[model samples]
Every structure is written in structure tokens, then in C-alpha cells.
Target: MKRLKYIMWYTGLLAISACSSERIAPDGETEQNIDVHLAAGISESDNSSRSDNNTYIKTAFTTNDEIRLVNTVFFNTPDFTNENTIFTYAGIENNKYKFTQSSQNDTSGNPDGTGSTDDTQPIGITWNDFSPTSFVYMFEAVYYPGNELFSSVPSDQSNVENFKKADLLIAHHRMPLEDRYKDIELTFHHAFAMVKVEATVPTGVGGLPKNAIQEASMINVQTAYHVDYTATIQNNGLRTVKGIEDENYPRTNVKMWLQSITENTAKKTQTYTFLGIIPVPNPNDPNEPIIVQDDFIHFEVKVDDKTTKTYRFVPKENAIHLEQAHITVLKLQLGKNGVLPLLLSAEIAPWTQASAGMILDEEDPTDNTLSGGNSSDDQQGGNQSENQQGGTEP
Candidate 1:
């Protein structure tokens, strides 16, 4: 009985040792090791083995983290415009007459050829109305930085995932003005112009943030004009009225003539004239620079009607005119990630006057002046009829 008990106890001890030595496969057959016994055994292994395994694990972890961070993409849209109108006019003879006449009107609806009415206000003209003009529209794209992910490691992997930051991009479209029009002016009418911008968010990559994606569109219409006039005279009108020498005539008139001529001569001699005098060091006179006065002189010449036989002359004055008009349209659209978002914008600008004569008479008339006059009369008649019926006129 003693022998039998000892044998059974030894057998139990052997079974327990065998079970502990048997190597069980890791959970789910995954490559990872979950053996508590193996881990403990590693502490007793050679230093080289431990070092190699640690290095492999760290490198694998870093590569995976970098892949996750660098999988993002970024995009954006820039402001653009469309539907613009432009008009231009050059050496507009009819407009000059109209403007001159308008300048002479009074509050009582009376007209004067002298253009000296206090109620008259200068006419503002646009450069776009005279000829066929072109309107340009543009679209652009731009980008900005997006979200970023930083590595948690202090020194070993500080920037291992830096590729996750957004990348910026820009695209633009431009049109030359001369290619579109033979002549361009900036005075008379607002130009119709249009521009558009389109932005697309790419798929399969991490896209922009919820508030980062944006789209914008805008339109600009503009016109410009410039007017210049000049005149000159050869003689002064102060001496000998009606071929009769007058001793009582003041010499101040002669002095005024000389002064006007001197001013004109000085103006003509200069290559460039300053609107205002600016003090500067004189190279020729270092100690005391001369103070030069700035002045603008307009010349005009006229014959003495009262002294027809005197052969009198006077200076003529120059004149300049400028006018401009513009209109703009702006639009903005925003998106979240790759999904299109809401849009907000505005259209604000001025309208230009239409030429009634040109618009009405499509075909050539026997008399151009008659057509213009008739058109004007018809317009006035229509306006009067509207007023009598209590209707609004546009």
C-alpha cells in the first residue's frame, strides 16, 4: 500500500510539469505573442535577442502611425465674377453739344448759350458707351493648411507623423484688355462682366475639415473716359478800338495780355507740370533754392464784335473732362469636408443711360438730325402722356 501511494503522487507531479512545459498557440493564431511564460523567459535570454525584438516593434508602430496621419488632402476656391457690362465713348461730338447745352440750363427750364447758369451741374460721362466693348470674368482657386496630428513620443518620434498637415494650392485665370477691344474708355456706362470659380474635393483621401472648404465667385464691370481741349491766340485786343486810337484806354489790359501770354509760354515750354510745387534742393543754387509757383493756364481767343475794323485778337483757354462708372457682383460658398455648403452674396452697382436715337433708328434715315429730333420728341411725348395718366416713367 505504501509503494502504490508513492507511485500515484509521482505520476501527478510529472503530469503537472509536462502540462507547464507544453507550448500553447497564441490567441486566434494572431502574430502577436501573449505567453506569460515566454515573456518571463525573455528576461533570461541574451541581450541581443531582447534588443532586436524591441527595435522591430517600435519601427512597426511608427510606420503605422505615419500612414494614418499622412492620409489627408486639402482644397479651396477663390472669388470670381460673371455677367458684366461695359460701355465707351471717344471724341463724342453730339455728347459735347448736349453737355454744353445742359451746362447752360437754369432752374426755370430756360436755356442760355453762354453756359453761365448757377443751377448747372457738370455732366458725368462714362467711357464704355461709344463703341463695342468687352467684359471680362475670371475664376481662381486657392488653398490653405488643414488639421494636423502630432506624435506623442517626446524625442524618438517627434515628427514621424508630420505629413498629416494640409497642403496649399493656387490656380488663376487672366485676360488681356487689348485683345478684346480696339479701343477702351472709362467714362459713360457700366460694363457687364462675368467670372466664375469652381472647386472640387477629391475622394479616397481625408478631405478638408468641417469648416475649411470654401468657394467664392465675383463680377466686376467698369468704364472710363478722358476729355482734353486746348486753344491759342496770336495777338492781344487792348489797343486801338475800331481803328481809332483811344488815349483813355487803360494799359492794364495790355499788361493782362502779356501776363496771359507769358503763362502760356511757360506752360508750353515744360515737359511735365506739377499740380502743386514741392520744395527741393536746387543743384545749381545750393545755398538758396528758388521757390517756383505752380499754376494752370487755359487759353481762349475771341474777336471784338464791337470793334469789327480793329482787327483785335484774344487768347483761347483749354479744358479737360473725365468720367467713370463701375459695377461689381460678389458671391461666396462654403462647404464641410467634401459636402457642398450654403452660399451668400450680393449684387450692388449702377445702371447706365441708353442712347435713344441709336436704339430707335436701326436703319439709316434720309436725315440723321431729323431722326434724332423725332426720337427726342417721341420720348418727351411718351413721358407727358405717362404723367397725365398718373403712371410712373422709367
Candidate 2:
């Protein structure tokens, strides 16, 4: 049974439509307060909550989930710096994030004492002494739970909750000061790469159990990332990513959490799906440098939940360069003498809006799945070297 796993919110994009009413200019001073409506479009893939049978339960934003906004390029307003503004999740309406009057505040978009801490009122942008001008105001919004600085990937990603926090998203939009009253929408993009490992034990492999692997992990990969949220405008009125690859990115081992395991009785084999989220950049312009690194796939074969033999494979394409908004699937086949042959492929799909709180599973065929997975780069019989890492814990 093949179905969409994290189809609903994998993009982690937000759509901020202007929902403000018509505000006439004051008698003396011509000024207008920007009432920007906030909504999240695509969410991070995978669900944190699980059922009793270890099946995943799809869920949307929690009550505490909040999005941080920063008006980097705006007309100079009094007493308002480029401090981080926050917007809380109110509810779901029409398959998008919905907010009410109580959830937002009518202010000058100041986060210092002017913003509400309880979320009864969220910070907003206001243009004082408003007038139609040729200048464009830029905004950069980021969605990361707790609004914490992410210097490195979390060591323990056994749960989707941790993955959600580390999976940072960013949106950049430049609006003309004259169009302040019109509807404005901000689209967010993923800043990390999702790696899906599929491990399979081939049929009739002598001296090996049908289900051989107990746990899997990705070892020694770049974990630290550049966290620049500044928006750069090109001469062609388009936005491009601006930053050099940080050489100081720490390389660390990340444990790949098991998503699902299945036994192919007809094929006489077993397969397991594992997932990991890593911070990687797909530079949109030539100003940014590409990052390459070597990653190792580690698997442990156990018997009765005890210590067992371990296998590690170095891919033929050791200089791995993963991209954002994409899934790098590594298909590995285990042979009898711990020899593993690996096939690597990546899939990039257009993001589609999904119904709020919709859960997609293998059993459900009516749900819409992402239109990808067939890649021309997918190849077999790669020159992969296997290394025995000694007996380890399962």
C-alpha cells in the first residue's frame, strides 16, 4: 500500500492575505494602519501524534504554535524597530489558518511592550502618514516553534515534534506602501532537506531473518546552517537567497526514526521506511555557494531486541548535495554477507493546498497524494562500500 505520508503541510508555507477593512484617512493627518491577515498554507510533513497501534495521527497547528514576523524594509514609523512580531494560530477555516479580532492587535507592529504576550492581540504593521509612493516595504516571516534560535539540528529526532521545531520555514514579500490597504499574501518556503531511507532485505538471503534491521541512523552530516532572514531584491524585481555557505557547520550523527515497516511475503523480503530532516540550502541564485558533504547510513540487525551486528554503507555519490523542498530517498538492499548496494534518488513536487486536518494513509485511496517519486536519476548497481561497525545496541 503506497500513499502520501505527509502531504498536507510539508511545505510549511504561509499565506498572509490583507483582511483589513477600508480605513479612510484622518481629517488632519493622512495615515493608515496595516491590518494584515495571517494564515499558514502548507505545513511540515508528518504528524507528531500517534495511535495505540503505532499508526500516525494527522494534526494541524497546536494552540501554542505561533509565527514570527519582521518588517525589514518598511517606511520609518515612530517607536517601532525591526523587532520580531508574533501571530498566534486562531483556528482553521476554508483549509487555511484563520484568525479573529481578538487574536490580532491594532498597533504600530511594535514588539517591545506594544505587542500582546497572551496572544489576545498579535503585533501588526502600521503605516503612519501614509501616501502612495514608489518605495516597497519588505517583510520576512519565519515559523519555528517557541521562536528560538536554531544553531544546530536537535540530537534526538525520534518524534515528529522535534522534527517540527527544527524544520524552519521562511517567507519574504515586498509590498508597495501604496498597496497597504489591498490584500497581501506571503508564501513561505522550506529551509531544510527531508531524507527518506528505505531499507530492504532481499528475498532468499541465506542466514538472515526476513526482518533483519531493528534501527537505522544517518551519521556524520552537516547539522548547522546559515540563519539569515534578510531579503535581497535582484534588478529584475525578484528575490534571491543571499549568503555564503557556512564552513563552520557542525557535522553530527542523526538517528532516523522509523516511519513504517512491511513484510513482502510474495517477494520474500521485508522493507522499512525511515525519515530524517536536515538543514540544507538550495541556493536560488549564483551569489550563494553550494554545500557538499559525506553521509553514512547505519543499520542495526538485532534478534529479540538485544545487541546484534551493525552495517554501514557509504553511497557511491558520496558528495551529496540535498535541496530544499525536496525528499532524498536512499534505497538500500542488504545481501547475505553484510554487503549493501545503494540507490539514491530525490523528488521535488509542487505544493498543493490540502483540507484542514485531513489524514492521508495507505489504506485511503481517495486522498490526494503528491505527484512525484519517479525520478530519472534513480539508478541501481551503484558502487557502494559496506563497513561492519561491530555489534551495537538495537
Candidate 3:
């Protein structure tokens, strides 16, 4: 898979490191940059080939000035180990100094003293507290810097599994002591999935006047979740997720004013498309990650205050859990016909994944703009932070 690249250095970074280090290059070689290829997706899907639409792959370095060498999956020992060799700082010297990935495994994270040449191992590089091991450093991250509270309550919200969407990118691994290894490769899994909704209002329906002004606005929208997404990471990579509410978004039913149905300038045709993040899961058993139902999305029409109709939107599928790094969409179709039963078709794929007859909604704020580059990065960062803030006092 082709590695997604984001060369620009960004600020407001929150890395999951332990302590700071005093190790800086005595020589002037600190300027030479180390190459890090980021694979932020599941292994099943070729991250190399993932399109930007299906995924939002970006980089938040260990620090703005320093690239900390972390102990990840390929480091050393067992099905799930949590001993990190934190290289708070280091500078790569000659090709002889290196960090590498090997097919072999040794408890002692030291380079094979046997002087055997293996392809996966790195050659000619060294760092502080570096250890050579055959273990693979598997990495998965869900970066929800803002508007991401794990648990809140109208009912006992405190015990309700307080999961704070990591304000920073929390990269997990055991730190290896100063050792030499080879080339670096990191794969990232999407901690959360997303879905977008679009409501279609065909003209000449809902007992409206025949002046081509038929439109529907989705108000009081709620993307309720039954499962707590902010799970605690266990030593073995498995998560300890407790049932919790979205503390930041206590009101599941917010207004989807952005996706309201509307007509063209001539006020003739009804727009048939829309988008959104993946809805919350309806977990069948609270203890397990298995989902038995779709997240709830209920809303009323916002265009006309005189019209009072509430619509319930549910995923087409029963189970709704995020596919690591992948997106599961909920496409909605509505009309006065009533016989169609308010259909929602859910499909999982890259961000651009869609089905036949589903029109791309024009209501997206990020439309025509890259999720990473452009001015969207700053705007998105601001929005994330804003979402976490408590509502202003009345």
C-alpha cells in the first residue's frame, strides 16, 4: 500500500510520551530529517492505496522539534506486551546506526550478536536506550482532539465510563533502551468510524402548495450511542470499554441545520443528498463490543414552523461499530409515499464508498477542500476544540 504523506509540520500536537530527554546531537547533524512513513489504517485494507475521501490520514509527530523513537508492536515479546523503551531524544548517525524490524524474536531487545544479515533489520544507525527485538510495533490511534467527551450523564454520568476523546494523539508502545536497528514503518488504525446523512424531499409532496417550494429541514437531530467509544487500552492491545454517554454532547438530538433539504435558486428541484460521521452503536450486550441495533437519529422539520413532523433515522444494518480506519455510511431516502418505510442503506468502505442511486450531498462544509491541507486544518482544529467547551450560560 502507498503510504499517505503529510509533510507540513503542525502545532497543537499532543503526543503520548513519558519524559523529556537531554539527548541532542553534539554535531550539526540534527538538521537531517528522519523519514517516517505513516500507515494509519487497518492491515486488511491496503493503506498505501487508501484515498483521502475514505480516510483522513495525517501525522502528528512525537514533538514539533524531536522525533521520539517509541517501543511499538514490533518491539519485543508476547501476544500483547506493554513495555515501552522511550527514546525521548536521539540523532541518527552513519548508516551503521539503525532501528529495524526483524522476523526473529528475542526477549533481550539487543541486536543479534551473531552478526547475521536479515533483510528486515536496519543497518548503520544508533540511539539512546535502543534495543533490538524481532517484535512488530503495532500502532492504532483515534484522534478526537475536541468535542469528544467519553461519558456524561443525565443519569449517573460520572460512573458512566468517563472516556475523554484523547485531546492529543496518544501513541502507545514500550520504550527500548539505546540500541541500533533498521528502517521504520508504522500503521495506524482508525479508532472511530463516520457516517453522513442526507434527506430527500421530492417536490409536490406533503400536502404543500404547488408553487415549487417543497423542502424539509432536519431539526433536533440526535446521533445517540449505546456503546462507550472511549475505551481504556489494556496492556494487551484489547480495550476495556464501559457503557457511557457522550458527555460533551449530552443532547443526542441536536439540529442538522447543515443538511436541511432545500431547492435551487429557481426554487424548483429538491436536493437529494447529505453526509455525516458514523452514528453511535446500539450495543446488544453492554459488556461486550457486539452491537445489536443501529444508533438513533431523530429530527423534526426546520424549514416550516407550521409543519410538525418528527422523523426517526436508523442505520440500515442492526450492528454499528466503527471499522478501524474505515467508514460505514448511512444513506437515507424519504418521501411522503410512506410505503418505502424511510430507508437507510448502510455500507462500509473507504471515505468515498457509496451505493448506486445515492447522490453526493452538497451540504458538506468541507466540500471541495482537503480534510488535511488548505484552510480546513485550522478550521477543523478549532471546531474540535469548540465542541468540547460547555455551552455558554443563559
Clashes of each: 45, 1, 52
Taking the tens digit of each residue's C-alpha lDDT, what string does model 2 give over 93-171? 5556543233244444457645545554333444442333258756656666455756676756667667556666666
Candidate 3 is scored at a TM of 0.40
As for TM-score, the candidate ahead, 1 or 2, is 2
Model 2 CA lDDT for position 89 = 64
lDDT of 1 by residue, 298-350 (tens): 11111122211111111011111111121222222222222222122324333
Q: Give the alpha-carbon lDDT of every model.
A: 0.20, 0.49, 0.32
Worst 10 residues of 1 by lDDT: 63-72
Candidate 3 lDDT tens digits, 102-161: 212222443755444553544322333333334333333222333243332122111112
- TM-score of decoy 2: 0.60
Sorted on TM-score, best first, the list reads 2, 3, 1
**Error in Å for residue 119 of model 2:** 14
Best by lDDT: 2
> How close is each model in CA RMSD to the real structure?
41.2, 19.1, 21.9
Number of the top TM-score candidate: 2
Error of 1 at 323 (Å): 19
Q: Which regions in candidate 3 have their CA more than 4 angstroms from the true location?
A: 1-126, 130-183, 204-269, 272-275, 278-295, 303-305, 314-322, 336-340, 351-394
